[model samples]
Target: MSEVNISELNDSQVIGWLNRGGLKASADGEIGLWNEAESALGALSAAQVRTGVSSGNSLQLQARDVDGTSWTSFLTLTAGNTPTCAIDRTVIGATTPAAATFTTINGKTPSAFGLSLWDAADAAAARSTLGVNKHYMSLSQSSGSAIGDGDTRYVTEAILTTAEGYATRLYPMHTGTITRVIVQTSCQAVNGSNETATVYLRKNASSDTTLSSSVQFNSARQVYDVTGLNVSVSSGDYFTFKVAFPTYATNPTGVLMRIDVEITY
Candidate 1:
């Protein structure tokens, strides 16, 4: 028979002998044998447990979930100076992290602007809201008077002068509904005679389709609403504005025109 005296050993030696004999000792001198059945009995409950290391200026106790996928700090103990614990939510892998709720972001209340959530897919792309409403305006000017003898001329280009006017094509930034359109023009006749003018909004190469009825110009500045006159335009679709003056005259020189379009997605 093998015999060992526990009173003849130090604390570590006694612990080793007891471990070899399938016995465990708690901090308070309680000795017991642990088995699979004992493990299923209950779990150890404690708010704080020593890590068996010397206490430093700061210490943090972290624990991982049962799946061992994520780790979270549970307790922090400090001795000298109080250390700050900063929790950062940054994904180190390619997959995005779980979503979190926040009242304010970057010091601005998201709910104030009706912003509720943001879905971040990756580091490069993120989505906040859906469609947006936008407005655009283009202006063109001509120096000399072109005879308006019932001929269609692109209003965006200066036909009678060498000056290059604004772009003749309007490209929408997004595919949406064209809500409104307004055309404003300022023209004068050199002979001081009243001239009739017709403005047409053309899409693509279909110039026969009139967006609006012929607007009569009385040799003065005027604004006309062409919302109901023009057809709906898609994203990247080009728009052409044409002006026709059947009665050519020298008085309608130095024409200034502006076109405004509104789109909603």
Candidate 2:
């Protein structure tokens, strides 16, 4: 909706950027004035990039649809340990762009990921080592298609101790890192019984990577956050979850899965 240029940075932001660069002008003659100008932008450095969330920095660029209800497209550069950058121009049903919209202009300084043409790389690959390759990551364990990787699931199978099947699958719409996976079921096993269902993240039916420890079914409402997982999946990868259940006296009804991902598109 609103956007301010990077030239309008405040005093604090300038000072922070200078401090981060360790820029100290050397001149004994001008020490009197130089000391006062410690907050000067003397170096090519920026300490903090505005965390563009609800509100924070002065330099921000945000775009919304006409109704301003759904976020049609927004390219917000968020600052954190994972200094993520996201740029989305998904105007699916539009014939032409509206006013103040960024157009695909040519005839400018072209950019390759590497310094030399021999050293080739993509945009996401270039920023991976800096830990900023991640674009946007979000999730809600609750049901809905509004979140980043929608957790809306429909597993309509009755699982008994005798049968275990591929109860979950994920078709990533974007390429990113899956940071977390939460699985909550309608049951948990008793202390003595071995009513356990081990879940795995299987891709293309090749190697089976265990998502979490064995999920035992006995209690009414048992939730398990899958551990030992930091899966990096592409948009084309077919990811299916294999649930293998051990012998049990009491069978479970269904399984609910939620995946929190850092999507870079």
Candidate 3:
């Protein structure tokens, strides 16, 4: 009979031989099967099998044992102790994150990312149609108006009066908290002792005036900026600007004015 030592084989060679129904003997020789109860077998050396696997390599189990235990061992590929596996979305199985759970993720803070609709809602605010939380709108009147002697008429709505040479324009504002309103006034020539121009912001019409500011023009052409006026506006509400001369003895030529409104949602 021929004898084969099991210690001289590797794992794959033993498995291959077992798959083909055990080892074959030389011609005209019978194979001898040695039992562990009768003979002692030597342990295989650790280096007898292949070693030194490449980095980022992994192993997977082929099957489980009868008791549901894994028979094969697997290598978990990682970089700097962190697993480099790609997790599928299906594996997460969560639709949304817990409250305040996403304040930071993967070492990134919320301020570093763009705000979504849900984020805006949480802050009790909303984005406009232009995807902006705050915006500035401006309206200007460039046509020259002459404030004649002793003119005290409050001009509302853009109207060119042939008798008084004054006009007004209506400004439509969006629904938001008005942060600031800046009114700028400029004049080319002033021909009166006290040439003062009063600018008033009227809500809805001429009667519902909310805020007003005045600027006095000297002998030379000058520009004035009126700022720090806060007012809250609602949807469908319109505003009008009234430019009136209170103490003008002679007409003021080349009068220009602009209004800037800052709003936040």
Over 25-79, each residue of candidate 1 has an lDDT whose tens digit, in order, gives: 4444434333333321111224332221223434444566568787666555444
lDDT of 2 by residue, 1-265 (tens): 2343335533333212332332232232111111244532223224443332332212224455668675454555544555655645545356434433222235444344323322325555556644665544322223211111112122223222222234444567667656556665543222324456666666655767776656654555566775546677786775655555555454343333334434444
* Model 2 accuracy (lDDT, Cα): 0.44
What RMSD value applies to candidate 2? 22.9
Q: Which ten residues in a row have the lowest lDDT in candidate 1?
A: 36-45
Structural similarity to truth (TM-score) of each candidate: 0.43, 0.35, 0.45
Task: Supply the TM-score for candidate 2.
Answer: 0.35
Q: In candidate 3, which residue pairs get closer than 3 Å at backbone N, Cα or C atoms, i.e. clash?
A: 157-168, 158-168
After superposition, candidate 3 runs with Cα above 4 Å error: 1-104, 107-131, 150-173, 191-195, 206-212, 219-230, 249-251
Candidate 1 ranges beyond 4 A from true positions: 1-132, 142-144, 157-167, 188-192, 207-211, 248-251
* Candidates 2 and 3, the one with greater TM-score: 3
